[model samples]
Target chain A: MSPSRRHSDPQPTLATVAERAGVSRQTVSNALNNPELLREDTLAKVRAVIAELGYTPNRAARQLRTRSSHMIGLRFEEAQEGTSNATMDRFVHTLVEATARTGHHIVLFAGDPDDPLDGYDELLRATAVDAFVITDTYAGTPAADLLSRVGAPYVTFGRPWDDPSARHPWVDVAGAHGARLATEHLLEVGHARVAWLGWEAASRIGEDRRAGWEAAMAAAGTSTDGLGVRITDNVDAARMAAHELLEDPTVTAFACASDTLGIGVLHALAERGLRPGVDVGVVGFDDSLGAQVTWPGLTSVRQPLEQVAIEIVDLLHTVLSHKTVTEPARMLEPTLVVRRSTLRDSAR
Target chain B: MSPSRRHSDPQPTLATVAERAGVSRQTVSNALNNPELLREDTLAKVRAVIAELGYTPNRAARQLRTRSSHMIGLRFEEAQEGTSNATMDRFVHTLVEATARTGHHIVLFAGDPDDPLDGYDELLRATAVDAFVITDTYAGTPAADLLSRVGAPYVTFGRPWDDPSARHPWVDVAGAHGARLATEHLLEVGHARVAWLGWEAASRIGEDRRAGWEAAMAAAGTSTDGLGVRITDNVDAARMAAHELLEDPTVTAFACASDTLGIGVLHALAERGLRPGVDVGVVGFDDSLGAQVTWPGLTSVRQPLEQVAIEIVDLLHTVLSHKTVTEPARMLEPTLVVRRSTLRDSAR
Candidate 1:
């Protein structure tokens, strides 16, 4: 049962493939990397030999010879807001899968968030990663500038909000669209007094989500005059704020900025002995893992993590291939997942 | 504000440090790697110049010269059980921090769960990582064997239960000890009919946790006969099994194998209109991020992830330095965190 006792077979090298195919070293190389240069019959013969021998290309050797590692660099930042951080985890999972699907692998690294460029510099000097995919870009972030200064190929998963005209490639989710979907869903379910719960910060992402909520409420022709609007991202703080909101008795539902705040709304309801779906409808953004198993299943907005990963990889590959990205900044839509938290009559 | 329009300074190289320190390139290199060869004043002067010049060593060039990458490889497997997988995430976070503190970095990769060595092979050939820190190893697992056959240095973050005598370095958390703590806590809080919720599998980890609960019950002189010991790791599946357990009405508390299973217990109690802390108490193993946010915060066993991360890095470094590891397989203790979920009279 212990295979450690046996001698291991050496991995098949280019020489082995060349010897098996009865081709010169250059001919085998052409067949593997520059197949179009060879005749159809020769290409077909070399391909058959490679398949029969089960020879895999050596990426490190190729990188050494060509100065390009088929690896993408990703920096895993420490979770600052620890409670609701699944969105980044989901992004990473899809990024790894998507990168692997395209004959590339991700090199995960952690850097000092305060001075992230130091980590990037070290990785660039030590490894053969061809490009990088930067996540969680914010206003005045130095990652894009550092990558540009060093002439390293990279793509950010967040927009360059500090400077829209900056020459960098990025992809971001439309948070405003996600917030509107949540607000509209609550309104459609006959909630007249829909209060907004948002983060108390001058964040671009936070502003986008709040704008969506305001627009949806205005379009519904409802006077949100007495609606309770609490500003704080902490769940406990949101719960405390909700206590005051519940005193009015006119607030029927809450449209939260994220699932973390939505959880707080549920806590407030439980405190007052108010049923979630029956007495109050709560909707949240970023359909995190917490929403799935919550007592009364949360209704939330789900970002297309898979598609976002694919787009980021595709865009990075474009830049690596020396092709201009037509639309440097791409925005994707978020979908709504309706659950028992909003479905009052459906007894599931 | 417009960094894109301004010119940036180039990263400092070894030559820059050497020039600043009024020393030769070889002297600078010796100062950084082998300070004992130089006088104390010379060594201090070189380091001061290096800090001032911001000269970071080139990792790739050093690997080519020395055949060491100073990196530890880690493979991230997709969560098969899906829900309640925060334990692995916490491990990753801590691992990154610990590796960085030792002037080393981690390389994250993904692989097929059924066949993991393929990913390791690919990474070994493509990068210059010195050693690997393997997590989530199981009985009859081939990762250790495959790595051994290739003569690759690695240390697992789990015990080698299938063969305790296997020549390998590992660091593991005492799962049975954690479970025992949880069970003892429940018993101390006046819970006589405390049932156990566990996964329905022959997992070494699962068995370890089960043994702790059994040992605790035996010590208390309580007959655990007909105790609701449902075996399903899935949250919804556990909830279904919990319905039958709750029918007995005498089961006042539960000691779950994991936080994921504990979440299911919470769901089951909510279904029966029973308050978590008031009517019944629930304790979970692995104080995961989910435990902190769940309503009535789950009481759980907190694994020392930071210490575990530190031990793994320290052990791998020892192996890389060709030093003898005193204890090949080290096991660490776990602490129990009491929260509102287990407290009957704590009003939030």
Candidate 2:
């Protein structure tokens, strides 16, 4: 009676497939797109019927009509420039897990922050992704120019340094706020001379974290002029710096920018016969797996990586759909996980 | 004279942009793709030329005619389901770093093992990629079916579970071999009551690792009748199991499937007032960040993830270019890294 039934071999449409498989259209779609969510037997039956009827959904036509590729593009600014093996591993894992929820996939494009605008142009012309999510943007990067030129819907993992007024949607952790919280925690516990072990001051994140430490010191009416602050990029440098700072004796607490540097600092402290909580309190950022696995586990600010990832995806989707976003930039609060690294046993 | 230079306003190609920017074509490409490799002024000039010309190269046409999309697809079997966040992150970071070396990008796709057939149709039907790399394939996954159907060249991270004769280009660390090596190390140290802490025994990797452990134990003339083996999926479960096994006073050494589980075992030993190297020797697989960060650092068999990733990409490139692979499947040797977890300072 239908166009498919009239043919010698009737091809099953969504309705026919649903009817034949004894499931709803939505169920059939779910079985095809996200089979993990469906029962094995139900999925098997639906697949068998679809294969038996040689039913092929016209994806191209559907994509064109809806303008939704069911695909997202992820642009990694750090990935191209050679990030540490650990950082890379965590990012990929988080990205895959986040996108799996939407039954969508990701296309990764890594570009140098120092490159001209051409890198953006190349990516734009290469794939037909519905939306884009950019990570780790630096000052005066070509990504900014490309993002503005293409006018493609996109979101960033970090704030752009060049333009605070840039109308791009972004999700970033309140680094300064978290650092201040860490500083305050140490002050409340009678640690007066709190030092700071951070990455290069040139990094925006480092600067923000430093600002928070200074603000906390100012609010507590403590003189920070004599407080130790060591800024370095390498773990070896941080270790050396920590050893030097510990020799001062007045430096009783340290707020580190990352867990990696914090670990190195811990090792250095241990070599000098200094206990973490009893001798010197330490607080690190990112609450990475290293934070938990370290001896006297690191008390650090946990960045909601999963939540940030989800929010970035959601923002990009909203922009792609031409919906109005309530906020151009959103900053999520970091939760300080009180682990053994900074807390005395009595405090816990 | 040329099609691009016909107008008074010449459209910038890589060559034109290079000439204007006073650099080589490769430099221009590098500047665009990898700015970190270049100086600041050169990058700025390249951007100026690109902006002035408003030049956009047709990537689709170039990809079609040259058979070079400059893009590769990364297929993961359980990436959408079963992998840990840490493992996933490392793989993604490794893949990104490995491919960036050749100026290629990665598109990630998750395949359903249950279907073992139509799961990869979406990736196949969409944009044409230069090559594909498959990771974490189960026994009955859709990878083989997709490979056969698409006719595109692909490399697998792990070997085929069934059909040892299956001639697919694969790059995997010899897990079983690593396990055997670990077991042999324990035996060489006069440890007779060595136990195995394994992942899910249902997996091909787990089975292979177990076989290696058995082979090594048997070679040392030890009976497998009462071997203490704990198989689990959760880290806490492995820790609890390790605690129970230690209570028996027979399990002297343990070789775990992963560093995560090994760390858990170490934590359990510590909880019972027993030091790992002094009371119970331990070895782990994957030699991940978890292994290094843990106290009395974990002794692990390193899988050479970077080497494997690079080799897989190289193999996929060759296969895509229609080159005959001299060796269809290559097995890499896993190296044992001895740390405080395995041997006391005096023992070493």
Candidate 3:
């Protein structure tokens, strides 16, 4: 599989066609596969450009020559038991849509959760998933090493946290930026002494998110002493930690690293008979289903997952066509969604 | 892509190897590709069987000759906006795991949500997804019809409700059986007038589930008149309907067709200052994240999604290997997960 990628990179055929047609690679694909999906004029324009470029619409011909599968392998990180903070489903949905237009499909498989590289090599050999798009940064480091060593074409949806020198194309959400927005939103709502409930120090993502709350508190001239708690990302553990934090009269709000942690704070508030937004404001990250449907709609930081998928596809164009690496990594900002949890009203 | 499936079906070489080797088809593939994952004795045994069966482990060679992709196409139904009743994610996780072991993968792409076949033809030609496994029974009719007409190999995860004459392999859960369990549980807990909150009459799955609650009520000899309300599956709509249902003091429990509706009932109860379990018992279908993580965990029907994935894979073996189909269609039962929503003492 890796050897197939080592062939002399093809000329910028699809990109040139797309640019000349003033449309996306996906649109060009749609013109070929589902022309009915496009307007008559758009379809005509795309077909004209495709014919002028001599871009072969037949993937079968390309496969015969280069063994190209036109499929990107993604190792699915299964949803954690009983948790709604899993973002893979949302990301995959958009990723599928983003790639489908370009006549590509995402090949989904489960690697041993305990071992990320467990079945990766076999998948490529057996399923012909010769290329990949990695999601879990922690596991992705090794995947990058293996793919790079083997010379396979691939991209990452997360930054290489442990490896500083790796130059593979990547995109990541600005975790600190999202957490800062969450913390700032809480402060704006008149909540003082907002505490941070986050994952343990070992997690780069957790620490990255925690930095935002710390920076915001420092900027606001608020005391951080005895106000922050770091634990494993679990509802029960975070809930117990939040219960202890709530014993202090001054802690009036929380900015959590993840929705699972945020839910724990809500659980603690429920136990203590404290209304979520009125008594103590709460904000979660990822804007997951739990945040959306929780009793007092939980305010959260929403990542631009759709945009992330689009960027990955665009990056694939560069990597596969061997185009100039204009941007090796992209850090997209996150937006805050305000709801009853941070609105100081509408709570039960 | 459809033309590729017209080749005469291959012999059951893999099945013979697996059975003689005292292993599964997955183990045979593992012996060929990722032998390190298996034990030394097991690998040796599988290799022996492969030799005796004269199986070709070289997919590259096979692909070159047959133009086979070994990729099963699936149209992703995106998660409903702000709803937790969506069950596609869980099903996909298991499907991917099940297929990976046998050197197969799911080619996930978004179809035009409006038209199930909107991008079907294009995806087949562009992605080389020569086979399929359909999930949405309603949209599946045309897909199955098209594939059968084209002589493509395919299986369905849902029953062919509108096409009983269809001979395609399928696996479906007993919706009525699941709903009956929910209603009877409420009855056993001293609730006589348990109501049914369900989808409108047009949905076959909805109607199937409704019959269970109806039968359970009749079996218990409880009057069900005015106790069943059908509407579109939405949280706010279901919540509004639940509010109206709550007006009748006799309606002490509700069995909903989906977790989204059950969450709605929870919202209505919160608004009326009524407790979920003590004042009103609520049960939802699918045991979705909403059911698991709601304020009072929702007691709901739990589909054997993992088992369904395994069944689909097993059916795939029979369909693709040209083996005699023992059971053209399989039906599995669902269980209930009891939680705080139905347990009176666990609520906040």
Candidate 4:
């Protein structure tokens, strides 16, 4: 379904409302903008005609010109001290930059973090957003189902977790590939018993990333027993888990599912007076601002968020142009940013 | 000037464009939506007239209906990890929520980090945004200067740092008061020689916050020799400065201008095997997400960002309605959130 398509009826203008209500164009204008100027009966009659004629006084004008609102709807997620907040924030900045080139701008709406459907429904009712860019599909994409049912144009930043064949254009970073790179680097640096501090198995992204660690460990002919730990993604939880895992002296490196977990490891090391990048190695995902600015600087797998944003905008343009998407999904590669946290040769 | 004010020339519509071009309404519509339907000469004639008549095909329709675009322009800052990023991010979320109630939405644009005036000029030229919500005015607000010259409406989140009698409406948090609260709390908790870790002297926010720490220390009749330090606002610089400051055993507490600097203190203490909130107390400003979720959570002075956002929106409505603002500057007080970093009662 083309996102820009609307009803074929001739759009009603101010003149049409004026003619239907048996009033001068000025009277109709006053009724719409400054109803206090009109007699009560005259205002009522003009308003009823506007309603009966299916004239949306404000949106009608936009529809008449472009057949679309050049605005793209995006839900600005809840503000929190979060690992992914920095990642999503940077991506949004790039998306804003990319959309500017096409004369389309992003309209950010606040929504309940637990309810992905909250802001989207309200935007659809109140605004003429031409399309939407959906994100945070880690649990599941109820947003995709809702948008598909409504025939609204949308592109997601994450792949549909449950269904690879979902009929939507999406751009996702290669999570499993990113984790594998981190594991390979740790192994190359002479850490055979590399641990994986990951999110709970239910998170699709966590599982995808963990799979890479598992594959890398198996390829290196290393036993994976007791080195894989699943926990909540917050710092305190990761810190406690990594602290306990550090008791095993053989586990000399960690490949983490998120920067939060990586930061947790740094804290755990600080408690024990262990020097990171020398005593042990760690790598985090998302390359968040938190990862870059933290003390000693966390080594992380940086998803190509800028490229993903550009690709998302390119897909938006395609759907808005009513062009068929030959390829429904685009996955970009993730690269590693080496910092002091993972440099084993501390002097180098 | 009222933000909604514009040139009084009658808005040109499709009918006007067609009449001037000696063509039918349908022909003009074709020239706009399907230019290939007309001969090259006719298309050129229609285009020339459309441009000359100032029929901003897409924007003119909106101008005709509301006389104001229901969009507010905001420049999304270059995403960075800092003490203020989370503060500004949360403020933006609240602003978006506040604008929604008034049938307005925020349009985010990206700009060069060093140039404050870049995106505003582009947004003014391209979009029909009714007004702008200027953030990051701590760097002297060149944007305010540009917007004032162009007669565009704008409200800054930060007060005019260099000018007390600036003309624009602004909503700013009470930085000095917040720091005073933090410093007083430290003194009340058995810390006499409290030290101040702040930004360089040139940063207006840094100086404002530092004044509070100085006031609190002096009010308690404490000497401040070798107890005040300033550096660039980053984790590494703060950490290094704090480490050197810690050589003085009498300076057992630190009140910092930012959470970034406060976290640096945590790092410095961790390296020295000193306990934060036990052997020493630490306090940060802005209560950023980094402060909230960091290990041994940082005690921080929290700006009333959500209330500030609401106030900014209210100011915007006043200007849009062409009302004279009797009071243009509104300052909200910041409160302190005590966490593990400042809790000397460890068992509690």
What fraction of the correct interface contacts does each predicted structure contain? 0.29, 0.23, 0.44, 0.33
lDDT of 1 at A36: 94
Candidate 3 at residue B117, lDDT? 69
Query: Can you write out model 3's per-residue Cα lDDT over A250-304, one digit (the tens) per residue?
Result: 8899999888788888878876778888899999999888788777678999999
Q: For this target, which candidate reaches the highest TM-score against the unseen true structure? A: 1
TM-score order, best first, reads 1, 3, 4, 2
Q: List the residue pairs that clash in candidate 2.
A: A89-B89, A89-B90, A90-B89, A93-B89
Residue pair clashes in candidate 3 = none
Which is the leading candidate under lDDT? 4
Give the TM-scores of the predictions, in the order they appear.
0.90, 0.71, 0.84, 0.79
DockQ of all models, two decimals each: 0.37, 0.17, 0.28, 0.15
Better of 1 and 4 by DockQ: 1
lDDT of 1 by residue, A5-72 (tens): 22245656779878888888889899988999999998998888876765666554566567676678
DockQ category of candidate 1: acceptable
| lDDT: worst 10-residue window of model 2 chain A | A1-10
* Candidate 2 whole-model C-alpha lDDT, 0 to 1: 0.69
Q: What is the lDDT of candidate 1?
A: 0.78
Candidate order by DockQ, decreasing, is: 1, 3, 2, 4
lDDT string for model 3 (B234-324, tens) is 8888889999988889889999999988888888987787878888999999988767777767899999999999999999978888787
The CA lDDT of each predicted structure is: 0.78, 0.69, 0.81, 0.82
